[model samples]
Target: MRSKPFLTVAHRLAILAYIVVALFPLFWLLKVSVTPNDLLYSEGVRMWPSRATFEHYTFVIAHSAFPTFFKNSLIVAGSTAVAVTILASLAGYALSRFRFRAKYWIVALMLVTQMFPLVMLVAPIFKMLSPLGLTNSLTGLVIVYTAFNVPFATFLMQSFFDGIPRDLEEAAMIDGATQFVAFRQIILPLTLPGIAATLGFVFTAAWSELLFALMLISGNDAATFPVGLLTFVSKFSVDFGQMMAAGILALIPACLFFLLIQRYLVQGLTAGAVKG
Candidate 1:
């Protein structure tokens, strides 16, 4: 049944309100990033100041170490995303398709791993990494982030694989394709949406991670953007302008990443793989 026009308008208004509420912080971030420093405090709660400037953007890019942080963050997040998605895709396919001994126990163990608070494990992790020379290194952060993100990504991919039918692979195998070939040629293609989603999810998680990056990285050289944001805080005052500018700049990679993947991110990758 078609809804009444008044009800449709009310529903749209409600949704618009929620969107505004959700995006208000981002709007504010953009606003502050452009607001002139002189007007920053003097404006005292105005949405749009009388004038705006790109001074913060210029300063952050040209004068600050934000570029280094950006590059480091890109490396860490990209590595983590790629590594986690690869491991998760393979593991998820196995979990979804193959039957094996102790499967339940293995999944249970993975679930148990996810249950522990990360902070509780930080000390142990630090001690473990220190002796291995993994501490204070970008590789160490990638390892840690990959480890943390894999279980969740595995589950995410498993859901997608589960939605796909086994018949396609079975038919491919019957037609003389090897299991690996069938998986690569047939199943993987249908899983693009899931892969894109997993990549985006893992990338964002590693990008914004602060606690582990802070504790593990001692120098600015290896610091991710989130950890580097702390540099804006001096003993005297916080440079909100440069910090917000950096934050805005930091969003570029993730936004670009999503833009690249969004075509594949459309849901229902398995739509035509199986009969409805």
Candidate 2:
């Protein structure tokens, strides 16, 4: 009943509204980060402050322990992403292509693992890591993240592999290429979108994770960004400006990481849409 132009305009408006709603918190964070300390309490909720300053940003970067926290988060997230992707790719391929005994049981066990709350597992994980000198360490964090992320990542990659025809790999094997060689040289290239998605998901999960980082890492030197954010909260007050500034700074790597993979991310996310 509606005109095409009217429907088109409605669609666009809906998308614009969604974008604004999604980004409003980030806009508020930036506004608070740049607002001067004096005007924050004096003036309640202005779209833009009368004046803004970089003093919070300066203090967070130069005077605080944020850089160390940033570095630790980067290391843990990067390592976990790479490790989980590699392991998941191999495991997912096997699950998609091979028929073996106890496969269903194995998958069931993995599903069971995901069912338990992470909080329930944390104490035992810490106990297991402490004896091995892995607690309070980045390597420990990477291992923990990889373990937690692997099941879902493997399932994600398995779905991607399922979407592809198996004949391509068969053709490669027929040409005298071993299965592993064909996988590494041929199929892996086609799976880039899935790899990007898995890397992005795992990286983001590890990046913003607060519980494990807070529980495992006691020393400030080993703390990740999520844990470091707590430093802004003291006995009586929270430093909203510096904390917001740190939050903004913390958003950079994640943004850049996704930007780097967004091409593949788009493909990965949309690949399933055409199936219907």
Candidate 3:
């Protein structure tokens, strides 16, 4: 019992340290966002401001085109998340269960796709899309983001599917269900954690992605939040306050998304689905 107390204290301290390290940047972002511009330079390195204001947030929301960029980002990220998760779930389950011809070659091909730097493909992708009127379009951005994100998402989901047992589906099929029904009814419920994790991963990736969004989208109408943040910079000066405020606001959806799905992420729904 005495040893248990010591272990509990140690565990709590470790968690506290990790929380502080993880949340420090976010705390600083909030601190700086509220600090007045005049004090920004004058304060130098204070941990907290002498005073705080909501002026930066007001300016970003009212005076800037951040709202439009935010809306576009939400649309792009949301669509990409759904598309990637759906494709990855199907592909992952197939990879986990099916033994078919050229499986090694197929996996190797997917790995090969991930090995190349995206920059190398930008020129080729742009040239390809230009002929099809895809450049400067939201649909193009969605399609591109979905494609880039799917390989990684598929690998993530495949790991989860691999964790689940095959017995559940086999039992479901023996009970007069088709393969698809067994998958949809029995196996899928057990993969909720994997689905939640995959959705969170893909959504955050697409939400913060800047390179492809910047390159493919030429106009404000289709600009993602990351690209829109660049507009806060001018030749003469950068609006640190507005940019930080927008940056802070940009985090809300991701935070909410994780919060919403976190329940599934925690419950090990597959725990009893298989034998030890």
Q: Per-residue lDDT for 89-206 in model 3, tens only?
A: 9999989999999888988988998999999989899998998999988789889988888888888889988887777788889999999999899888888999999999989999
Candidate 2: count the clashes. Answer: 0
User: For residues 1-276, could you state the per-residue lDDT of candidate 2 as single tens digits?
Assistant: 756998899999999999999999999999999998889899986999999999999999999999999999999999999999999999999999999998999899888889988999989999999999999999999999999999999999999888777777888899999999988876888888999999999999999999999999999999999999999999999999999999999999999999999998677443443335
| RMSD each, Å | 1.1, 2.8, 2.0
- Could you tell me how far off, in angstroms, the CA of residue 18 lies in candidate 1 after the best superposition? 0.6
- TM-score of decoy 1: 0.97
Better of 1 and 3 by lDDT: 1
Window of ten residues with lowest summed lDDT in model 2: 267-276
Task: Give Cα-based local distance difference scores for all models.
Answer: 0.93, 0.93, 0.90
RMSD of 2: 2.8
Task: Please give the lDDT score for candidate 3.
Answer: 0.90
Task: After the best TM-score superposition of candidate 3, give how far the Cα of residue 2 lies from its true spot, in angstroms.
Answer: 4.7
TM-score of each: 0.97, 0.94, 0.93
lDDT at position 27, candidate 3: 90
* Superposed model 3: Cα runs more than 4 Å off: 1-17
Which model is ahead, 1 or 2, in terms of TM-score?
1
188-276, model 1: which lDDT tens digit per residue? Answer: 99999999999999999999999999999999898899999999999999999889999999989999999999999986667566566
As for TM-score, the candidate ahead, 1 or 3, is: 1
